[model samples]
Target: MKTHRLVQNFSGYRALICALPERSTEALAPTLKKLGLQSELIGHSPAAPVVLPFENINADRDILFIDGDMTLPMDWRCLRGAGRSALPPAPVVGLVGIEAPSRLKALLLLGATAFLAKPVYGGAVYSALFLGVNEYNRKEILVDAVDVLYEKRRRRAVVIKAVVSLMNIRNIDEDVAYDLLRKESMRARLSIEDYCEYMLGLRQEQDKNENAHGERQALKG
Candidate 1:
């Protein structure tokens, strides 16, 4: 009833699940049906970012969650009231079990509202989803400077164009890219936004060096 009530106002509301075999998906059947949400199964691998079909996530029925291997780029508390405002902010019910304080702080800075640990039960799942929906419905949507900073930093045209041109293109968002980079870097806890800023700085430095080299060559000529 809670899920239905939440979805009733939205058109074609759906939930996509990226779950592991170890964690059976059968338990989510009832919740899916109650919410009229579509479900999909993805193999569990830490190497993969939780891949939800973005086409399914739009203005209509836009609420979404990346249930596995999702690490935040900043403190999620900064994202309070994101969904209701004109900016994008759907509630994220994260599942972080015994995470490091640094990891938790990063998630909080990114504005995550709830933490649903692993080995979840029916009640815990229900509570997190229902409460997220309730909070979403009650608030005014608004994204802050930090969110904007993340968005702008993450979606550079050159990077997006490069990604778009790639035959194996995955998520184009920079936050997604940053997370992947951190995963590959073997860092303990790197916020996507923070990681992006560092990478961007590196790129700028490279460009500056190239420009200086060009100037030197012209002088030699």
Candidate 2:
């Protein structure tokens, strides 16, 4: 929901070119400069010498140009977020020299949002950047949505437990107990999950106090 409905304007964004030959990125520079992007070329084999590590890639300001022909310091695919991270950290445009299936597969694994042929065209640069950046943004939105859904699912059990406790303590039906909790949560300006957690914690503290009181009473007797 935080995503801007409009496609992002690329003025002042950094273009990180990952390739061995400086000539590889030669054609890309002027075109990007025209669009207000600052181009930084990385020609090192290990990629550590020229620029920041791929792990530090920021989706908001960084756009990557990965050359399929170049020797990668690390697996470019590793740059794409997976497992706990659903979306890639930045938009990637692949500069593909080889047409082999294996090479293309590597690019796909790298989560390239778009592709350009071996000879980068000045005319095609804008389109590729547009698609790549917007595609990354789209996936980021999905990742955030998934995270929210996961948190809600995890808290579902706590909500049920709190509702059941209310039913038992107040001598009411499950429906009525849920209604009370929902209303109280709205009044407290908290999410239902948060309200449930608060109720559960309060109940736990009260139970401990009651147990301590009973133990003291028994000792006195």
Candidate 3:
């Protein structure tokens, strides 16, 4: 539900250019410098597979310019972080030399949010950076929302358990129990599931204490 503001300026961002030495990347570095981005040219060979610095990539500070003309037999799974989303660690702008579907598909698989045509022009660099960064931001927002949904789903069972427990204890209906939980959760400034989990934990501790006390009393008797 949160709206992300579009990133217009790319100041202090690092552009990681992964292309062969023979590729026409001359304009890229200088253009990026004008936009306040530090450029690092990653050397790649046409005969050998491209090795991307997957671990070193930071979504906030790094943008990738990948050469689509070259073949990269990389394990796409490495791009995923702890959340296991297929998104790249940073914004990706594919360098398109070949207009073929196969080449484009490779870029897509690399999670290219924007594209730069072959023979990088200074005119297009800004646009590519803007689009790539903003698109990545949008995807990140969506991924965060998905993560929240998954967490809420996982805690649904806990909510149910709490509702049933409250109903049985207070001799109330399910609706009343649930409403009580919602009110309490609001007062506690926690999600319904989170409040329920906390309440259940407290009840568990109370039950343990009572059981221990009873055992001691019986032993003394």
Backbone clashes per model, in order? 22, 0, 0
- Candidate 1 similarity to native, TM-score: 0.42
The top-ranked prediction according to TM-score is: 3
Lowest-sum lDDT 10-residue window in model 2? 43-52
Over the stretch 1-221, how does candidate 1's per-residue lDDT look in tens digits? 01223533322455544455445345653565565566555445655544444444443354444343444232323334334333224555555655778667754544456666666666666666666565555432333444666676765654444333332346456566544665743573645345545556776798799999999999999
**Which pairs clash (backbone N, Cα, C closer than 3 Å) in model 2?**
none
Error of 3 at 2 (Å): 7.9
Estimate candidate 2's alpha-carbon lDDT, on a 0 to 1 scale.
0.82
Q: Rank all candidate structures by their lDDT, best first, as comma-separated numbers.
A: 3, 2, 1
Give the per-residue Cα lDDT of candidate 2 at 18.
80
How big is the positional error of residue 117 in model 2, measured in Å on the Cα after superposition? 1.7
- lDDT string for model 2 (81-160, tens) is 56756555678898988889998888877778899887887898888998988887877788788889999999999999
Q: Which ten residues in a row are the worst by lDDT in model 1?
A: 1-10
Residue-level lDDT tens digits of model 3 in 1-221: 55797988899999998887653668898899999999887765556665677778788899999888865565656655655565888999999987999989978877899999988889999999999999989988898899889999999999999999999899999999999999999999999999999999999999999999999999999
In model 3, the worst 10-residue window by lDDT is: 75-84
Which pairs clash inside model 3? none
Off by over 4 Å in 1: 1-12, 24-26, 42-49, 68-89, 142-221
Question: What's the CA error at residue 91 for candidate 1, in Å?
Answer: 2.8
lDDT of 1: 0.51
